[model samples]
Target: MRKTLLTIAATCMWLAGTTAFGQGKTCEEAAPWSNMAMVMDLASYADGGAWYKITPTANSMLPFSLTELPTSAVQVFKGCNGEKALVMSEEVASGNISYYIESGVEYMIKLDVSQATGSFVMAMATPLDLSNAPDGNYCVKPINASVGMYSSIKANRPTWFKVNIVYPGMYSVGSGFSVPAEGAAVTSVKVKSGDCGAVENSSNLLMPNQVYAKAGENFFCVTCSGDMKVLFQMVSPVASCPNHPERMTALSAGVEVTYPNAVYENYWRFIAPETATYQILDKAPQGTILQVGTLDENDDAKFFCNFENGLMAEVDESGEGKLLVDMQAGQTYVIASETFNMLAEGVPSVKISKDETGVRSVSGSSRDIKVSKVAENEYRVSSYLLAEGAGVYVYDMAGRAVSSLNVRPEGDAVTVKLAGVPAGTYMFLIVGRSKSASTKVLVD
Candidate 1:
């Protein structure tokens, strides 16, 4: 969906008052939840007659008090078998809500409270994992929000190997391989001539890569007489590797081996060079999920995604994260379930450099730009800069600003600090005494 700031604001308002939405398919549906992608909404309510945002713990239950229950809080429920359930007690005064989801199905609960009315109606601002629901039946009888579930990803094949030939010249054929996520490990790489004659067998030579695919086209040698196919295999004990973020199924392929003294960048663009499309992918920890609810005031609920807790992408209620990423025209992306909130909303782009000519040296004074997170509840902001006194902040998909540091001209070096931050994309800005220059940074 093409989200706008207004849309986010509206969603937040909805969450503040009530909670409704689940993350996966009903028993009538079948799929591995949302493939590790997610779509989220916000909500809020009053507590002890005082309004505050509610944060769910790893256990799938909400902390509540009779003194905090109000008519403005919206409550949602679902069946244990992934079936949609009705709101048992329509009154917001009810202190607790419930749901029932079946095994193998994922559900998302949303609570938007931007409106503080004492009543709420059943409405869906967004759908969680409805597209790929598993087959079954279930009901919602008031499930705890803190319950945790174990989930796994089905192994497939390698994605692709993107090899960029930096040096330009001649290329030859050697041995190579690729690996899929949590499958088998490559043991060796071997190349052969047209008649199965061994051309190269690699035992001492080692390729550090685990996975690779062709970006566009494959390469071949000009002197090769006929077509030659390279074969690869891997070995691994069943369940030898635990559920690891970096584990993968490994394979190998043949590449044009360059001479020891050759000066060339010519290389083959190998596509699907692995046994299959089972590449290493990050999965959410057991019991991690997103619910749609609002603050006590019926305002939007604000939350963040964290790798520390298995959240891949997070953004504030302003839809700023969607803006930071390059969006496509007509592609689907996961928001609150998995896949770092998959986003295929815009056309893919590559940053290119152009020749530049300007004053070689420029000098200016130093100034400290004070910055802090919006709240202790806010996600870590990854990068912060002063865009002409207008601070430009960057956060992870989890909505935490990863970097926030003061920047000012001091001699030739610009002052920058990257503390308490994780590796990800970031935006930076520096407002000079008059103009401002903004740039992107990759903290890898």
Candidate 2:
């Protein structure tokens, strides 16, 4: 009886191989496998299993899937002899599996199954190259472009694109395609500098995916699970304030202008007529967000300060929606205003005026108070106006008070120490009984 069963199995195997099962049953006779090729009806063969060999020309991360697996496991080995199993199926779904391979290495994949009468399809995925894709700009409207060759992202694998950035700033990448709710979500979207060696930043498929990129060639790797027809859009901070003259309004001192009720934010360009401290006041309803900054040659936002709900530290208790900023002569600055709810209602007015408080000038002061850096984190403040128990305060560029101390003048100068203060540009304000002086200092 045992010999009869063995003979029947051998005859079945021979008949299957001669008819529809051409794949090798042993590692030594494994057939060659190529990228994006599908092997159909793999489980219909009478042989217990089949083997296929793969040789990658370049290092790659490949994903393999089975339509209807009839076995418990599928494995990849380092060589045909199966001495070492590099990876095994994790079964993301019932039969889907993925693995990574290196260049110049031979890999043998085995589909382990016993005489199953069912059929299954095996498919492999390869990376899609977009290294030479044209550069995209955030300031311009996005145009749809086809991405992968396959219809499904699961079969297309990861898609890589290069970004040539001329300016270092905050940027965002968004996809026009989305995975179906029934399908798996996108695995990852990564940003790398120079090459695809290491990931510098990653983003989700949803939300405003943002990444801070430097000036150079940056690479992006996107992996998804659904449709492959994706259109990726890159957005920069400049997208908010376009370079058109109509978009950036010119703001002059002492001139008040009514902001139109619009959904988008409004921008104002202010070129300092003279080097002085100026105050920007927003009389826009009760809640509004104000931002002040300058655009570099590349139109990247820099030195920006956000006043949440139009509130600033410089404003007094009675003052609302006011910001005092020290501006330099001949330098251009940008002022942006937006409603708290992202939609403006009624009339919103903004005004820029010179701040003529008793505070000394930032560039040069005619006040009696004088401040000089004595050491790395130490400064000598001298002034006859600084009486006993005078208040000394330090503020950062964002108008936030960092440190404050009360001291008595040591003869002509009082040593003020900033031990924990970080190195940057700061403002020092010294207040006496009836007078106050402020000067800007750079700490190294």
Candidate with top TM-score is 2
Residue-level lDDT of model 1, residues 192-238, one tens digit each, is 11111112212223542111111112221111122222222122221
The numbered model that scores best in lDDT is 2
Each candidate structure's TM-score, on Cα atoms with residue i matched to residue i, is 0.20, 0.26
Mind giving the per-residue lDDT tens digits that candidate 2 earns over 108-200? 766654433345444454532222333321101112232222123342256555656553345554334543545544556555543333224
**Position 163, candidate 1: lDDT:** 22
Alpha-carbon local distance difference test for all models: 0.25, 0.53
Cα deviation of 433, candidate 1, in Å:
28
